[model samples]
Each structure stands twice: as structure tokens, then as C-alpha cells.
Target: MKNLFFIPFLFLVTIASAQVQTGKASFYADKFDGHPTASGEKYRHNKLTGAHKSLPFGTKVKVTNLANNESVEVIINDRGPYVDGRIIDVSKSAAEKLGFINQGLADVKLEVVDPGDGKASDPGRPIEHVAVDENEFYEFEISRLKPKGYGIQIGTYQELVNLMRLADNLKSSYKKDVTVQVKVINGIKYYGLILGKFPSRPKAEQFREELKKKFPDAFIVEFNRL
Candidate 1:
């Protein structure tokens, strides 16, 4: 009876581990080097690690680039690729190995090889990718975005980690709430980092002036559309 129970459990684990997802993959930007990742470890572009919207941190995943048929195994140490349709964000080394470093993005398949411990890997990072419905990851900012509000738009980036690192730095420097808004325009994904939600446009403009000293391109944005 003991042996029978163990066998069934092992079979179930096998089935779960075999589950696969197919979507687009991208790589970390150089600007993220030395920044804290969701795993609480500083990110190194050379590390064979990745970020997924929902995968538990520390999980080992096999990522296969469909275009070139190149595959690389990476550890999940962060959360994101927050853009719509993106499934995974690999480190620079992983991108180079997968043959997508120049292209910057590739369609890929992901298979979980190891399910990591279920715990908050980075307490400072907010959990933004919960399943709100079947087959979709919930985007809090996009869903709850107000038609009219004031926020300081720092910069837009194609790489998620570059945007995240900017948000992390703003949070550390200003000790304010920072948010990353994902937008897909003309079939290209852009991550926009916004800091400090203000109720009035004037208040937002005032802060934008202060931020302009550091981020010259920073400006106020009024959330109106996706």
C-alpha cells in the first residue's frame, strides 16, 4: 500500500512538470546589472536566470527558441516580462545562447523542470501577476487605471528589467510608490515607469519639475487609454 501511494504521487508530479507554455521571450537589459531581483539577489546579465509572470522563483525552466531551435535551461529568479503576450525574460547570457540577443525577442516554449519553494522571493517587489481569470495574468495598473490622474512618467523601455531597475531606484531614492505600466502599441511592447500618483495635475507637474533635474525627459502623464 505504501509503495502504491508513492508511485501515484510521483506520476502526478511528472504530469505537472511536463506542462508547457508557448509565447514570446526576451532578455534582460544591461542597465539592470547589480540591481536587486525578485529573488533578493543582485542581477547579473551573465547568470542563467529568468523572469516569469507567474512562475515561482528559483524554479528551473527549459526555454526553447522556436526560430533557431536553440534551448537553454534557466533558473527563475524574478517576476515579469509584464508586457502582454510575453511569457519569459531571460538573462543576457541565456539570450545569447538562445540566439535572440540581436533580435531582442523570440517566440519560445517554456517547461518547468523544478518547482521552487512557495515563498515571496522579494518582499519589496509587489506581487502583480496573479491569475484573475483562467489563461490570463491580471494586470493591476492596466485594469485599475484611472481616466484622469497625475503621474511622473520616467521613461519607456523595451526591456522589462530596465524599467524595473528605474522603478527600484526611484523607490530607493525618493521612498515613493513606483509603478510600471505595460502597453502594447503597434504590436510592440513598452514598459513605462511612473512614480508617485498624484490626484491633481498641478501637483504632478510640480513633482515632475523636481524629477526633471535628474531625469530630464521625465514628464507628467494623464492616464487616458491603454
Candidate 2:
């Protein structure tokens, strides 16, 4: 039960946990502008918004570039940096403020100044990962139960605690099953948050359209050996 502490930590994650991290940070490409973010808001290059691997969305974080000591505050609105060593992704403007737009990536330290208000997706003090207990968190195993179907992949996360927390929250709020599918990408362990089981691509696509209001990046994935 390694990370089972998350079971009780759910109610207080916003209050009890104050995480800090140090890693590489990159900014979104110009193409990402106007696309729907994980928080259901349009991605704007000028906005002070960013994406994190596992901080609650809507939380504010202070990003400091170790090179020049330049810093900027951004609101967490998405998830990512599946890139091997990156920890956070910011908007073009944020990168400019941090003085790293030309560098593409910068060594940075992150500190969470505030937690989310139940929105989309961190901070830094050097915390490596969120805690999650396997005995209690792996309950949403949709692969073996409905292995052959179309599932909507809303998000993919590194820490199981982040995946578990979102899955539990969705199941309770939407009153629908949110499946957890474990996979390994580029030597990294990740858990994907999937919603609904549709029999066909058209059906799944339709559902995805409706879900887009909440999850703009939602995409359909076929569940095979998954």
C-alpha cells in the first residue's frame, strides 16, 4: 500500500500538500494557441497560464529560471511535458517573462503558491512525486473488463495519485465510470484517464464531441490488448 495515503489525502490535497519541484520547463508552440486546454479554456499565448505534470489545475505557481533568476507566475490549466525530462509547460508569454523563449527549454524551480479550486491541473520545492497506495488506487481497471472498445482518453499522467484523484472525482461527479489504463511510454510509467465505452468509432467520436465542452483535448482510443 505504498501510496494509499492518497485515499485520505484526497479531501485535503489542496490544503495539506504544498509541493515544489526543479526540472526543465518549456513553452507551448505557437500552434497550440487557441486550442482547448485541459481546463476547458482556449489556450492563449498571451495569458499567464501553464501546464504541469501533477499539480491541481487553477492553482498558481511561480516559475524561476535558474539561469537568470527570472520568474513568472502562471495558472495551471493543462497537463503535460510527456517529454522525458521536462516538468512543466508554459505559454509563449510566460516563457518570455522567464527569459527563455529562444532557448526552448530552461532549468527552472517551481513553487506552488496556491492550490486549485476544482479546475483543470503545481508548484515546486523539490518534491519528486505525489504519493499513491496501490492496494486502494487501482480499482478502476477497465482493460480486462471491457478490453475491446473505443474509450475517450481525457488525460495521461505520471503519478498514479493524480490519475486516481481525477478518476475518483469524475466517477463521483459525473456519475459515470472513469477507467484507468496503465501504460509505459519512453520508459516512464503512466496512467491514462479514460471515460465511457463505446461500441464503434462513430459513437465514440460523437460522445467525444459532447465531452469536448469539458475536455477539449479529449480523443478516442481503441482498446485492444489494453
Candidate 3:
């Protein structure tokens, strides 16, 4: 998964839902079954759950198909609709309920369904966690070293060669430092390259200017710390 500044699935969704007021959402069908969800749950495309950019897990939401006004309630179980311009991603069953399974994605109005002081299920223990080292010497050493600067994810794509080539060009022509990495998202392999780390946004912008002159299509993106 693209780990940059992304929230884990489930809890904390209420905080996420509050960020955006309006947008469009879509869904997944047979193609996504058995894939890993943003919350680390294996995505069963048939489940009566969904993935939303925001909205706390277990938060029941009524999605109305704008085209036909058909509505269905579903719990926000995961994160994403990562495709640009989409608000939420529904399971195949939820999409069917919205009357858009036959047409694939649908235009819908997503409203949060408050559970009314209802406590939702925790999505289980997180799959990954950082463990603090107990070795006194190691801890002391780590404390002394100056922190390495943050790395920003400039862009990620399915093509590895494309990312590698871009990295090589950046290294050769520009004195700016860069690195390439691979991340798996719902079984899709994406390559991401970092353009350099700056302590401030203005410095990052300065570096972005030089990058734009070369890779005009490159976009500046912020890396959200996990």
C-alpha cells in the first residue's frame, strides 16, 4: 500500500468523514474479490461493506444512486475509492443495491448514518506495529543520530520501468536526490519515486520548480506519516 500519510482502516473514520463535504463515489465487482482491503481485511467483493476515503468503520451509511434514487445501507469497512475523483467504493452487493451493478460505478449521494452512541466493532488488531527496542545501547545510539529528512512520494504508477527511467534521469541531469520504491495496493504493484526531502514546503517547492522544468508532468505530493 502507499504508506504515505494514509490512515489505517476502520476506527478514526468519523474524523476522516468530516474533511470532505461532497464528492462522487463508486464500487468494485468480481474483479476485486479476495483482494486485501485498506483495513487489512481480505476484500470479499460480495460482502455488504464498503471502502470510503473517510467515514469510520462500522459507520452505517445510506448511499442513494443519483440516477435512480435507489438507496442501500452499508458499513464503512475499509479505506479508499483511491481512483481520482471518487468519494467511496462499494462492495458488489452494495453496488447492486444502489441499482448500478449492471452499469458498473454509479453517481451517488453518501450520507453518514450515525449509529446513535452505538459502539462499532474494532477491525481487529493491526497487522503491523512498531516495537521499541529495549537495548539500552541501541536506544542511546538512535537518540544521538540526527534524523534523516522526510521522503515525499512524487508519484506512483503500475509501471516499474517508467519509474526507474524517471529516477535515472533525475539522478543524471539534476543534482536533486531521488529514490524509487515499489508498493503493493490491493494486489496491484505500483512504483513510486521520491524527489528529495526538504524541511519546509517552500524548499520543497523550490525543488519542485527544477523538477517541473525536466519532468513537466511530475506532481508534488505530501507524504503523510503513518
Candidate 4:
């Protein structure tokens, strides 16, 4: 009889353990505000809510920006991000809190806090509480270190050689000034290939369009130097 009781407890633990997922995350566009979500709630850009494909509505999740190590707690209130390769779509406010509002997308990890069982469950207990380390976080703040300006980022890579090779190709092919910026997030090194600083966003956008022909993934980025 005691063993039978243990089975149910084990089942819940299994469910909880299986809820962590990692992938690319993006935020809802402004157009989605006030729209009906799959969960029957109206989308609100300011809410710390998110959309997940399978997690039950009301499930709380802790989303950590793997690149910057910034984490935000949000409730899963909708379904999707239907775009390929994305795991979650966060609210605008959540994205801002995660520090990926400007980038539009970020690599993230999602840990399910409560499974929406309607039971009071402590969401923060199972996860090890590590002191929030801001040392590494500030190191990656590009705007803090460089003058604020617009530039075109062609790509980000984990391998330094790959980043250098791409930068070399862009410089040689277009005879444009290319720069490699390195950022370390969550102990992983990323090299970003950037081209030309423009004083205005319009100038940067124009150049981005031209670069798009050669690099389909290229996009404009703003650097706010602190």
C-alpha cells in the first residue's frame, strides 16, 4: 500500500523534471496586443507572460537568456511562436526584462516552475539558487563600452576562426571595413561580425539592405556606449 502511494509522487516528479527546454526565443510583435490567445486570455504586451507550444496555460516558467544570463519569470498564457526553431514567444515586457528587446531574438532556457495544476507549488525550490552574478553580465553590454551608433551585424559564431574567416571574406569581397566584437555569455564565447558604423539609423538601414543581397541574415544593430 505504501509503495502504491509512492508511485503517484514519483509520477509528479517525472513530470516536473521533464519540463525544461532550451531553444531560440522571440517576443510578440506589437500587433499582437489585445488579440485573443489560445488560452482565452487577451494578449498584453506589458504582461510578463509567454506562449509555449505544449506547456499547459498558467504554467509558470523561468526563462533565462543563455547569452546574457538574465532570467525572467513568466506565465505561459498562450500557444506558439509557430516560427520554425523557436521554443517560446515572450511578452514585450518580458523580452525587455531579459535584455533582448533590441536583438529581437535570443538563445534561452525555459524551466517549468509550476505545471498549472492549480495547486500551490513552490516554483523556486527545486532549482539551485545561485547568486545572481552580474560580473559576466556587464562584460557583454556593448552599449556600455562603445559609443552608441548603428551597424550591420552579419552573423554570430561560437568558433573564433569561423567568425574571423567570415569577417575576412566580407572585407575582401566588398572592400568594406569589418569589425569583430567578442562577447562571453554563460561562459560561452560569441564573435559577432559587424560592418561600418553609421551616424544615423537611416544610413544603417540603407547599408543593411545592400548587405542583405550578400548576407541574407544580416541585420541592423544599435550600439549605445555607456
Candidate 5:
């Protein structure tokens, strides 16, 4: 019987080492504007994504609050919960699902369900690859995009034209891409102007510094993409 147990124990150990790992973590919410996230995607508060220091982008994680045993599946999209000793930065929705919104933070357990390509996606870092032109009009930039990322928004306005103008100005100054989008809420339209699908906060903030020269009131927000 002892020998039989030994075989099972070894098997269990091997499986444990081979599969993904889990650890205790503390989550954070989006706090500032113009902060880039790990996976070159913009950060969005309403997203179901999260930031982990080491997990590869596009990896899925199941986070459970040990205190309450509340669990939620968070796709690893960004690079951090940068604070020391913290393991992840979860979206507000994930925190809410984990029943920790009122407390603002919680001690949770995070298990990597997928390892991805072993790189946590950050928005600031640009990965270059071959661009394939499928046709005269379509050019496909073929690179392994880690599928999830975070970005910071510089401003949101009630007028689409104003947002457009701001986005244009930012693009001219930085010589980079700027995007504008319109959102409808309760029949009212609002426009959002954002910059840098950067992978890291430092990179986003660097761009934010330039935008400040023209738009003093610009603030930061998060955007996420699947």
C-alpha cells in the first residue's frame, strides 16, 4: 500500500510542476490617466482583464479570493500590479465579482490557466515584424500580438469634433497614431481621445507629457482590447 501511494504522489508532483502555477495576490484598480499597461492594449476599467507581472499576454487566469472563495476568470492582458508584493491588477468588475469592491482590495489566489508565449503583454514596448501586403489596399502586419493589452486615455469630451481635433493634434506632435471614438450613453453622445497603445506606464506617461503641452486639462484613463 505504501509503494502504491508513492507512485501516485510522484505523478501528482510531476503534474503540478508541469501545469501552470498559482499564488497569493492583491489586486488594484486603475488610478491615474495616461498610464500604459503591460500588453500594448489600452486599459479600460469596465474590462474583464488583468495585469500580472509574469504571465504571458492572452493567458487566462482564475483568481479566487481566499477569504470568500469568490472566483473570477481574468485574461492576462497587461504587465503589472506594479506595487511591490502585489501579483495582479484586476479590473473593477473582476474585483466586484470577487466581492471586494467595497473593501477596495483583497487577498486573492491567482492560477495561470494559460502560459501563452511566456511574455506578459505591455503596451509601451513595440515589437517589430514583417508587414505583409496582401493586396494594393490591404497591408497586414503579421506579428504575434498577445491578444490583450492596456492603454491610457488623455481626455473625453462631449463633442466629437473636439475629440477629433485633439486626437489629430496629438498625432501631429508625436508623429504616431491617435484614435478617437464616440460612445452613446442615455442618448447622449460622448467622444474619447486617447493616445499610445503603449505596453508600460512609463511609455504612456512619456507621451502624456507631450500632450500636456497642448491640452493642459488632459487626464488619464485605461482602455483594453481583446
Candidate 6:
């Protein structure tokens, strides 16, 4: 809930996975139910289908709510979410399962579980495909750190005001030590917010579940004692 400096959900997951995309996601409107989609199939509200800017019509993608870590596998059957900063548009049912139907927009990570035929879903709608690197972002790799215990990274921001604002709020609300980690890229400075010093990975992980209620994208980090 800050400025869209391009960086999205603040969750870190370790796994053997596909190219993960971090961005904002939205659900389809109820009015579009039963309407014809780009793939020539009718859009059903209950179907676990979604629209991507360029993935083939039948590609299966796993969309994860970075905030809450909820995930849903949906088949790509349309092309859209034409709005800037948004990565995908899922069916209403998928959105409900992902637990973001009420918020309408959720910060998410997308993994292409299965690549479908590399053919256009809609000839009428030209593919405005953007490579993963083309995504706008403010987060950057930090200089090596020698933190003691583990930490939880909540979010990163281009605006120090936003970063500090969140840090102050989180510190007071959670009663934890807050740290602002800085990194510079192309002369632009970015800040990463971290909550500190959980004695062990398991301790940090146990606390992570509680923080997810508010910062769904929060993730564990190493060398956080610094």
C-alpha cells in the first residue's frame, strides 16, 4: 500500500521453480463472466483460468499471492490486464482461492508451471509481450552483509520516505528491531526493510506466519543480525 515504485510483493521463497515474476495481479470483473475470451473459449467465473500478455492459450501458470503465500494454478486463456504495473488477470474463482478477491489487486509472483503451445491466443489482439528483465523494479542486490541471526524482509522501496514510513510503523506495531538496508544501482539508491535477529531459521519462520497477516509478502533473509 505504498507508491508503485515498480517493485512488488516482498516474499522470498526457495524452491526449484520456473522464471518467477513479481508484480501486481487483478481478478476479472463479474460482468465478464460467460463472455468470449481471446482463446475463443467462454470465460466462466468458476474456472481456474487467467490472462497473460503473451503466454500461449493453454499454458498452465501457478500464481502465488506473495502477501499470504496462497497459490492457484490457472490455465491461460486470454490476454490482458492492459493496465500498467499489473502482470496478470485471473478468473474470479482463482482470485477467491488466492484470497485477494476482496482487495481486487494483490502483489503476486507467477511461475509458468507448464508452457503451452507457442502460438498466439488471439490473432485480433496482438501480443504485447515483455521479457522478464523488462519489468520495472526498485529492489537491488545488497552489498554483502554479515548479520548474526536471521531476519524477515518485508518490502523494498525506491522512496526512502515510504521505506522509513513502513519501518516506523512496523517497529511500533510489532515491537521488533527495524533495519533499513540500502543498495545503489545505476546511481539510484533503493532501500530494503528488514525485521531482525530471530535466533534461528525455525524461530524466524514461526514468526513469519504471524507477520503474513499484515505483510503477506514478508520473507526470511540471512545475515540479518547486522
Segments of candidate 3 deviating more than 4 angstroms:
1-21, 115-226
TM-score ranking, best first: 1, 2, 6, 4, 3, 5
lDDT (CA) for every model shown?
0.66, 0.69, 0.54, 0.64, 0.52, 0.69
- Deviating ranges (above 4 Å) for candidate 4: 1-17, 118-226
Global fold similarity of model 3 (TM-score): 0.43
Using all chains and alpha carbons, the TM-scores for the candidates as numbered come to 0.49, 0.49, 0.43, 0.46, 0.42, 0.47
Q: Give the TM-score of candidate 6.
A: 0.47
Q: Per-residue lDDT tens digits of candidate 1, residues 1-226? A: 1110000000111122123788899898999999988768788998899987665555678999999999999988877877888888899999999999889999999986544332344534665544311242212232233434767877665545334333443555676666667666677666666777788998998888877755667788776532
Q: Give the clash count for each candidate.
A: 0, 13, 3, 3, 27, 5
Could you tell me the TM-score of candidate 2? 0.49
Error of 4 at 24 (Å): 0.4
Candidate 2, superposed: residue stretches over 4 Å from native:
1-18, 121-226
Q: Where does candidate 6 clash, by residue pair?
A: 10-217, 67-216, 67-217, 147-223, 147-226
| Better by TM-score, candidate 4 or 2 | 2
lDDT (10s digit) by residue, model 2, range 103-174: 999999988765433334232223334332112423332224445678788776665555555555555555
Error of 1 at 203 (Å): 66
Worst 10 residues of 1 by lDDT: 3-12
Evaluated with TM-score, which candidate comes out highest? Answer: 1
* Candidate 1 segments whose C-alpha is farther than 4 A from its true place: 1-18, 119-126, 129-226
Compute the lDDT for candidate 3.
0.54
* Model 1 lDDT, full chain set: 0.66
Where does the lowest 10-residue lDDT sum fall in candidate 4?
3-12
Tens digit per residue, CA lDDT, model 4, 123-197: 222222222111111111122234357878776655343343344435545566565566666665666667777
| Candidate 5, 67-112: lDDT as tens digits | 8998999877765555655667788778888888777667776765
* Model 6: number of backbone collisions: 5
